[model samples]
Target: MFAARFHPPMASAPPLCRRGVPSDRPAAKDPDAPNPL
Candidate 1:
């Protein structure tokens, strides 16, 4: 349930998320990360 919201952003940047970008870590949890897309 909690992951639904985060899914969108993560889906948008799966590469970054998969790469485990430390900076993008927060972005995976929230949409506050600098959207490179």
Candidate 2:
């Protein structure tokens, strides 16, 4: 669960942050929803 909590920000922090400017909250939220391995 830590990975789920941390990985997305670690992986998508830049893109997420970039999109966050335009309110792309879902983009970040989407990753957390997936149990991608």
Candidate 3:
């Protein structure tokens, strides 16, 4: 049961990381412009 609980969540993690939509922070298009975060 303990292994079952941990394994499923870890398996799903890779897809989330690949999506690259981390947090609400915005990506910068230009270095001179202010950070959108």
Candidate 4:
């Protein structure tokens, strides 16, 4: 399952990195979540 662990963070990192805001925390938690961006 080690690869699975990396996958989640890798997938989440893109949106958070692009947004570069604390709001990304929630957005990353919920992919369907809407963002002002």
Candidate 5:
């Protein structure tokens, strides 16, 4: 059954990445702005 397959304790979960950086909002007409490619 599905319940038996996932019944193990979840204490071994991997750590999550939380290093988010704040970005500046570029103007709509900025010719030198980097493309979001």
Candidate 6:
């Protein structure tokens, strides 16, 4: 319940990172590290 605000920022962060400008946004590293394929 208290995490409501975090949820939106979490979703928005990834898309913004993909825009290329935020290439250094640590969040992007998490997804790529697990999918070595």
Could you tell me the TM-score of candidate 4?
0.48
In model 2, the runs with Cα more than 4 Å from the true position are 1-9, 24-37
- Per-residue lDDT tens digits of candidate 6, residues 1-37? 7599899999999888687666655556767776664
* Candidate 1, superposed: residue stretches over 4 Å from native: 15-37
- Candidate 3: list runs displaced more than 4 Å: 21-37
From the highest lDDT down, the ranking of the candidates is: 4, 6, 2, 1, 3, 5
In candidate 5, which residue ranges exceed 4 Å CA deviation? 9-37
lDDT of 4 by residue, 1-37 (tens): 9999999999999997778775777668677555433
Evaluate model 5: give its TM-score: 0.21
| RMSD each, Å | 12.8, 14.4, 5.1, 10.1, 9.4, 9.8
Give one digit per residue, the lDDT tens place, for model 2 in 1-37: 9989898778878887777676666765677568463
lDDT of 1 by residue, 1-37 (tens): 8799888877879776666786667667566454543
Better of 4 and 5 by TM-score: 4
Evaluate model 6: give its TM-score: 0.47
Identify the candidate with maximal lDDT. Answer: 4
lDDT of 5 by residue, 1-37 (tens): 7666555433223221121211222443253455542
User: What TM-score, over all chains together, does every model reach?
Assistant: 0.28, 0.29, 0.47, 0.48, 0.21, 0.47
Q: How far out, in Å, is residue 21 in model 1?
A: 14
lDDT over C-alpha atoms for residue 20 of model 6? 63
**How well is each residue in 1-37 modelled by candidate 3, as lDDT tens digits?**
9999999999899977766664323443443256453
Q: What is the lDDT of every predicted structure here?
A: 0.71, 0.73, 0.65, 0.78, 0.36, 0.75
**Candidate 1's C-alpha lDDT?**
0.71
